[model samples]
Target: MASHRKTRQHPKALKAMTLALAGAAGATAFDGTGQAAPHPTPAQVKGRVDALYQEAEVATQHYNGAREEAGAARAELARLQDEAVRRTQKLNAAKAELGTMAGRQYRSGGVDPTVRLMMSADPQRYLDGATVLERAGSHQANAVAGYARRLGSVRQVRDRARTTAERLERSEAALKRQRVTIVRKLDAAEALLDRLTDEQRRQMSPGAGPAAAPEDPARSGAQAPSSRAARAVSFAYAALGKPYVWGATGPSAFDCSGLTQAAWKSGGVSLPRTTYTQIGSGPRIDRSELAPGDLVFFYSGISHVGLYIGDGKMIHAPHPGAPVRIAPVDEMPFAAATRPA
Candidate 1:
């Protein structure tokens, strides 16, 4: 009777064990404190998206530089090719004249003067004869020398054209690769943005929240140093809300350095097309010495730049999806500042 009673309770014990295992598996989702970690908030997502966009901007600058180089290289290649063609025409004309001279010599039974001189039995007599021959054929001799010089020049020009063509090809390849990198990074940033709710996207947009308040000029620590600087600052302000377009130095859109380059151009200053080159365009200055129209570069590689507009404020095209706007100078990591002369 005891053995039968134990057998009856076996199924109940098995059911209890199964229920305990399922409850433990459910509990594994929580932390040791017994609370489930929350999902990433909108602000966190925004920060990540902004970082990806910034990286894309860096690649965009590289792409712009490569494109400019490729353009210049193509122009150079075209010029060189034209030169080569002209040189070849000249060479062909000289060769034709030389051939005519050879035919005249053959018809007259006149051997080459150098060969005749070499086979001379009487050296003094041959020298005297050769001097008269040289005076008579001075025009033909000059043509021969000219042809030799032109042939050498044509060879050099052809070689140079070949080299220029190779350089242009390399530049074109680099531009394509940089463009690919920029697209990839921008796509990643857009994917992050897509994950956000409409309200979250709005909060993170430029000029949408309290953090996007208009910068107070009085609060800025510096002032425009010259009329040109002031004009640049004015131009930057006028460009507010313009979209950031990679490699654009334009009336419509701009990248980080493009905005600064265009703004300063309005002030009658020329800046290089890329951030790396632009950094070397002026004298380096301390952050405390910043003034309006001074370029404030950011990131360790100095890949980003903005025009300081005074009172610790700067006007910049921050990144893709963000327009030209005024923000505090410390919005990103500061690398250095420059004052264009």
Candidate 2:
């Protein structure tokens, strides 16, 4: 009887076991479409984020150029406006003097000078006296010519100011659009990074990642090419942990090009504010010739720059979420190298 009871389990218990097995099978099986969604790996996310940041940097440079143009336009407009005011004042004074002369002539019954001369009994004597009048008339004509020239100049200035203002407005609009695009790209990159797990985030960080390993002493110990180079490298080193702020050329924060420009500036060198221009500021050199303080550019468009600190390492303000830090020189695609000092 005991053996029989063991073989014949309760119906509810048997059903429960069957349902549990079915659920387990369903969990491991394919979905309704018989396909699985692909999840991107951390490395894939990093690569995409890097690309987004690079695009944003390109837009940043355009924004900077527009800002410069707008500033210059504003200054030029102010100068033109001041000159116009001065010219207008001179024109008003000349018109007032001409009006006074017209009032005197009207008060004298508006007789034509030539008619009055012909009507004189002694015409030759009248003609001789007319020399003094001729000289005065010539002076008045000169004054009228001066007023006309000034009026033409004022009109030209107003036209130029108007043109410049219109150009500035267009530039401002383009800058706004660029800023919006940059924000969208940065937001997408941040969302990608946010999807990473805590361990993945830490792993992706330049300060904590395996890629951030220290450089070999021998490679990092090369001497600077000059005193200026040494000073530039030293300045970059002093800014190791500052936050990366777009368009900042600062004592506390910087973008990639801004950091390099500021570093070189501290060394008594003036570099262009944008990576594209900064790359052209010095003679190009081969990567094999890279030394401390040499400027290393990255990407096909040369949109990124960093100061080489020897030992196959470089100091740079990496991106918005990153900071001024040392990284491998080959961290991204190498485009060119330059020696500014």
Candidate 3:
């Protein structure tokens, strides 16, 4: 399952507190306005956002480890399978050669009926020759069969090893995905948590109203793979409270793709609109070399994009009905990766 560190405070507890506070504040208001209430304090909102950022940080680490483990397991399985294949081929070839030699010996005109009759008086010699040939043939056949059987046994053991490796790979992959998902929750949780520090909350997003959000990013001055990814994530940090919109790229509102596009542009590269196009355009890369500004594809279809923030993390707009945020690279149900075009 996806890993997450739940807050000491529960959502129900927070709801109850909010209701109590709202009631108290409502009672104190003058003129029975029953009117518009004050928004939460900036400090409260900021606290929630901070919590999300911190959670993302922790989740990122877990995701990184999981991904590495899964990849290693898969590599091991591949190696074992390759060895098994070679062994099987060698065993088959040996068996086939033995079959050819045995077939030729049986099919050859070695027994002559006329010659057998002439050696009737010394039938013992004939019998001895036939027996010697039979024994020699049996020994040769047994040697070839034994070699083939031995190799087959070795192949069987290798196959078992391969199967075990595959199981391990799958488990590791699942673990990696789980950690990634929690990181997304960590991002969304910040939205609800935003109520804690209203001041910092406003800083998460900009509006005509007074400044209420925190400017200090959860991760500050992180050395990213590229200056472009860094700038993009920084811009995203400014969009903490924006509502998630479907397919909306933005100066204001944003969907996951939109947010990624805007952030990468900050670094000077222009990406395509959808995840599919972006994935097709970039250079393919193995996991070990992944860097910021490089587009990572999740679910194998390239439906997600994030600015690599280095250290196994990426700042991104995670999904529909979610906020822009930072998460581990292995997050987004990772399928594969690519460098920017």
Candidate 4:
């Protein structure tokens, strides 16, 4: 009686319980925990997406640097291997010469020339000939010593080439890992962006259009300090609306550092391939001293850069999904500036 009552709930209560369970099951789960979590607001999603983009860029820069190092390492390995081959050939030749000498001596009964001279009929004449024989013996000893030296040299060169080959292999592996990291981060960012409404995405990714220029005080006929600088600045302006492609140096798209490098190149100055090295390409300058065509670096790690076009504004390829456009220098946390030319 009482047990039967306990097993039977009110119809309304049972219905409510069923509805609650269904709602819980339908909500989104996070971290694979299977528990429902609150959906993130657009602002929160934007923050996370931006952080992911920054992370991806950092990885992209690392990948670029690693790729450059791998290239040089591969070239060095090739040179070392070539040297090893040449040294081995010389070693083989030396061994063959020594073998020939040994064969000749064996065929001659390997008798002591000095002993033969002592038993000669004309002992003085044979002794005079013994001097020539002694000279020949000395030459054989020198050949053996030369062979040993060549063998040692071949071993040393081969060892060095093997070590270089190993280093090159390691560098190439690191490059592959970095590339994977960059791709994963970028994909995560894109996924987050996909969750947003179209209007939300548009608001979050401002300056995404190729022809949409940012409003800047420097937009009105601003001239660079020098002719070269002027050319660089002009190149940057012409590059407006180009998409940002990590590790790209452009006629089409570019990364932050690539855009700066290409911009300076237009001005007849060559900059290093990475932000960390590009900072040392020219003299360091204060923020107040920034001029048109000067390279402005951002973030503590100096992973980002732009070309200053005066009035405290810079033209840069901001990041993924954004085009080359004008933005205030203060848009990101400023680290340092350089005058590359």
What C-alpha lDDT values do all the predictions have? 0.80, 0.79, 0.60, 0.79
| Candidate 2, residue 335: how far the Cα is off, in Å | 1.1
Which ten-residue region of model 2 has the weakest summed lDDT?
209-218
TM-score of 4: 0.76
Better of 3 and 4 by lDDT: 4
Against the hidden true structure, what lDDT does model 3 obtain?
0.60
Q: What is the overall TM-score of model 3 with all chains considered together?
A: 0.37
Tens-digit lDDT string for candidate 4 (29-143)? 5443577577788889989997888788778778778877888888988888888889889878976876677667668888344443433687446435545554566765456
RMSD of each: 9.1, 12.7, 18.1, 9.2
Error of 3 at 20 (Å): 19
Backbone clash count for every predicted candidate, in the order shown: 4, 2, 24, 0
**Model 2 segments beyond 4 Å from truth?**
1-36, 109-137, 206-220
- Looking at model 3, which ten-residue stretch has the lowest summed lDDT? 111-120
For residue 311, what is the lDDT in candidate 1?
A: 70
Writing each residue's lDDT as its tens digit, candidate 3 over 1-341 gives 98798769889999999999988777767334665556656655545554564445334434434555666677777777777777777767755765565556557955333233223466445344544444455555344445435555666768777677877867677666756666576657656754545555446544314222434543554455556666766777676666555435687767556776777777687876666566665678787887655666665445556666566866566533346665677654776776765
- Measured by lDDT, the strongest candidate is 1
Candidate 1's TM-score reads 0.79
Model 1 C-alpha lDDT versus the unseen true structure:
0.80
Of candidates 2 and 1, the better by lDDT: 1
For residues 138-239, write the lDDT of model 2, one tens digit per residue: 654444445455656678888988998898898889889888988998999999999899888777764743224444433466999898988898888788
lDDT of 2 at 170: 89
